[model samples]
Target: MSPILLTVNAGKSAAVARTDAPSGLTGIDKRPVDGEVAVSAPGPRGVGGSGLAGDSIADLRHHGGDDQAVYTYAREDLDHWAAELGHPLENGVFGENLTTEGIDVNDTRVGERWRVGDELLLEATSPRIPCATFADWIGERRWVKRFAEAARPGAYFRVLRPGTIRAGDRIEVVHRPTHEVSVAFAFRAQLGERSLRPRVLAAGPALHSELYRNATAWAENA
Candidate 1:
């Protein structure tokens, strides 16, 4: 697996990001790591927090999964964006604590689970799509909408048991779901796939409740 950069932040600029913070990512393996995270996410920009409230990574990541990590990404994903879009997706590209390689993060489904170590169980909960904040940061609105259209939506896993996660941990997909709820399908439903909403909602409450809440609301109004 390709080695990716790792970073940790006790607090950020609250305005900027780097510059006035201690880079916890470097001392990870006791080496001057290659790719330092491009940015750091704490309270709002976290994977689950919705950028609204809370201070912990757990508060940020959806389903209240792990406290220390809110978002994670593959170093390759960052490289791909940098090469294609002329900008790199650094600092755990979606606010993930553990940036990995060789793991199919986008191919996960709600209720799906994986075992990372002796006690860590990461389960696929929901898709973490672009939000308004992402648009503001990237300086484009289409990536968010386009991402929803492209369908390779990234999954958010709830940490079942606590365990120490390092930079080079191999995250294997132990349980794959039998559903076909791709990002495209999610967008399709968000656009008009009303019929399938209820079923998707029924499968995983923790995963789909947000979307499920909307689905039911739409269903009642319809």
Candidate 2:
């Protein structure tokens, strides 16, 4: 089935937080919303204007900005988690701006671009690296380790074209780079397997700028 946006989500404030949140503040508790939302390039913190129009990033040091402008998660993966956790996994619960259906988000390669609705163009940049904030948000024991081990971390994107995005908007793959650095591969390489670091180089400069910098730094030090 063709991938479609299952939900459009955003947050107006950083109210979604735990008293003991690792980062001290977190915007990971996004909720779904109705109507159309604008999608655009990085704004103050590299956040897109789409469904993430007012989304806030608590830990600017690590999350949000250009390469991490928008996050997309798959309903299929959410379903898996729902089954595993024995509870319902709602859209945007993971702080993603786009909850997509029928997309192999984990398998999508870095640099692949998707056109949403008429004007939004987003390019996959990197896989989310679970953090203490995420673990605390889910209230699951060892959630970070479990999520990393699963290797199904969803993808982050950089907005290429600005436009409105709403639920049921169609997604079309407009560009797919000739690289093997899928989101899952990149996630495993960075978090689980150091040997795969070299593989990330195959993605070239199209790899997320931050990830590219990290890989370059690793290479320089190695």
- Top candidate on lDDT is 2
In candidate 1, stretches whose alpha carbon ends up further than 4 angstroms from where it belongs are: 1-13, 16-69, 182-184, 191-196, 206-208, 215-222
Q: Quote each prediction's TM-score.
A: 0.62, 0.91
**Residues 155-177 of candidate 1: C-alpha lDDT, one tens digit per residue:** 55555544544444456667766
The candidate maximizing TM-score is 2
lDDT of each: 0.46, 0.83
Model 2: per-residue lDDT, tens digit, 49-121?
3226777666666777778888999999999999999999999998889999998999999999999998899
Q: In model 2, which regions exceed 4 Å deviation?
A: 15-23, 44-51, 220-222
